[model samples]
Target: MSVKKALISVSDKTGLIPFARRLVAAGVQIISTGGTASLLKAEGVPVIGISEVTGFPEILDGRVKTLHPNIHSGLLAVRDSEAHVQQLKDLGIETIDLVVVNLYPFKETIAKPDVTYEDAIENIDIGGPTMLRSAAKNHAFVSVVVDAADYEKVAEEIEANGDTTLETRRKLAAKVFRHTAAYDALISRYLSEQVGELLPESYTVTYEKAQDLRYGENPHQRAAFYREPLSDQLSIGNASQLQGKELSYNNINDADAALAIVREFAEPAVVAIKHSNPCGVGIGADIRSAYQKAYEADPVSIFGGIVAANRPIDRDTALAMKEIFLEIIIAPDFTEEALAVLAEKKNLRLLRISALNEPAKKVDNLFRVAPVAGGALIQDFDYKQLEENEIQVVTDRKPSEEEMAQLKFAWKVVKHVKSNAILLAKDNMTIGVGAGQMNRVGAAKIAIEQAGALASGAVMASDAFFPMGDTVEAAAKAGITAIIQPGGSIRDQESIDACNRAGIAMIFTGTRHFKH
Candidate 1:
């Protein structure tokens, strides 16, 4: 078989030079456009400019570069069928066997706080996807590669089998479609947010595989990590494991819970999370004291729970943490000595993430995906956050100063617990949490039970609405003096009446914090 023709274009020049060199060694004729063409030429690769291939100069602000018939016909031509081959020959169009491309950096361009509209518009690519789709549409006879990581595999295949097989071409085409769809989603979401719309009718998103895990939620299932095409800010993708075994799915979830709960505290503190609920939490003079007190709050739960510190990890704090069997520890910074102390564990995941205590700000990437019966459900992640000042007194009796402190602590704890969440707190320590319950009353009872004697002076907080006063009656029975919740249930008045009659102080923030 003759050497195949390959089209190459990308905004990210990473790995392009070596990839193009290998392709050249395989005797593939490389064609590229714009900066990619110039870049390849500078690297001494035999690359033809798209304008030259099409016999048309790039026009319309470079928008009309690759939209011509020469490029599309070349990529879409069928190489196997005699009739299609003769038709392509009659049209004098070369059959393209491979296409490799990455889209324009639109999201990165607009991420700058002071990015101009002209800059954003200029960064948008017009012809890259057109060529990618054309190549993918003819996958039966053409291979489409969207990511540079696949370059090595493609090169190896051509070196061994003389060309990528039909199966490889089809798989590459699948990646092409996914790449284009994700690219479009990012563009749509950006434009919608720029115009202040909630959800658009159409969407596009782009993510590349980060790594393939040993297994998924279970050892038997398969799992892989994919991150957004853009930068990861405060996400699990960027977390650093200072020491630890390979993270299980449950470990990641619990670590996320630990981090999420600590985000609720404006003041520097330490929170220990186990099974997605705060088993221990405290405000302290410093992180070391806070962690110590939090550990003392529930030593049993501290055995393997994740710990999140709002302050930096110092030598003293790290040494203190070393005495525990924590799965993960997160803080803004870690001292050299602190990291050294942590390094001794050899299996503890240590993450240093800044900007953890920032006020709730809306994120553009909030689309959620969940599998349904026939398809999947996609919606924006709820951005509601309960500010300390926004809470309102609903009951006739107002909470005393002592009760207010515990109420605030419980409120913060409840936000991090899964729904139907019920958190009981005394001062800064979380005494009990009934998370993932079926009903509000049940949640209250579970938390009260966990609190035991500690429930006497503690305050209670709920993540969502209270259907009736049964929860209030339950709290009163458990000796809960103050309660804070999002009041939007069908029987809100009944709950309020029960709170008033039972002499239990209650307040509503009108904001629910349901993790599930």
Candidate 2:
């Protein structure tokens, strides 16, 4: 059960020298290959080259090293089995008590700018994973270490017990498999993306844990946060939490919705979210004006909501925000004065995302995944934007220039709302929003009622077309002057006729935005 010989081959040489010295002090012979052997010799640690043990030279640009039975047999031979020991003796193979290895930086190589296909392929480690798996499979006797963080504890255990305990070996083996599986999955995903194969017969993805949350959507449910590696896109995953307590499940969800809605505007904008749906949204020439307009949109709902701003928040904006009991405030940046003012609310979560100032770009992994009772559902992200050329004037009267601008703003806000959705807007702010209703008319009625007198001249936006004219009638009754929707229902003419009867202008976007 004592470690007499250990093989070390690692690309990440962190803490390698000290660990190697510790093994040498314990009378454990170190066998190494390539740069690892060179570094050990330079550090004055007694080492034996891999060629000395295998009696074969490394070939094919060092790709053929450690693929021989001389190496794997030493790792795989069962120490307690009489036949295994006899085979090792017959083949003149020594027992390898431990393996220390880490794979090539394939993920880092592919992440580089202008990296070639050959570069990525060359970075894939064949021998490293093979050795780790071989040692891991025989974990009852051989210990395998993949993570540098485990080196100190492993060295301590070996110094005290003369060998790593069976429990430690088993845990290390499980970690090795997880690490190799994630590595293989990354390689597979990169190759699949190159061939434009998004959905393959087998699918696998991996995420690194960011933090453990206190609870999930409810207090009883446990949860954790995981982030995608090398994700450069501006998202909630990449935001830096500068202040406030840890984010809860609902806080992250609502903040993500607020950020997404605010990003829809090129101008200075603010969006307030409640329960993962946009309660208020506004665009203005400056951050202060924008926040004011967003607050005026729905003062009651904005009380405990999440607020996201596209522009840097200033003193005035922070002063205004301090009046509310907001759960979180996210923006590109916050002025020193603004931070000092907002710091008064110790529990308010503050997040800064510099990418918010940059123009939006296409992300590599653009998919929305939702978990169901049994399996899951995956679909393309709704990156669709309304274009000028895609608009079709279906009503008799055309929208005025002012009405058209409000219609566009309303359309953008409606896309982020839950369906069936109805949103009313005036100027550049949402006045009322009704989302997640069972029927279209019911949603419209709720929006109209919320808007009240504000609905008289406001424009309405629907995520999808109206199945019946009742929605249009409801809007007309509320004095809504303009409407925007994707017109493709069997009773489209009924809605159009209702719009004409009320002299309301309407436009069909030829596309729908349905959020579930």
Counting clashing residue pairs in each candidate, in order, gives 10, 0
Every candidate's lDDT? 0.81, 0.92
Tell me the spans in candidate 1 whose CA falls farther than 4 Å from its real position.
17-26, 159-161, 202-206, 357-359, 364-368, 376-390, 394-396, 488-503
Q: What is the lDDT of candidate 1?
A: 0.81
**Candidate 1 total steric clashes:** 10
Q: Write the per-residue lDDT of candidate 2 for residues 42-75, one digit (tens) a residue.
A: 9999999999989999999999889989999999
> Ten residues in a row with the worst lDDT in model 2?
357-366
Clashing pairs in 2: none
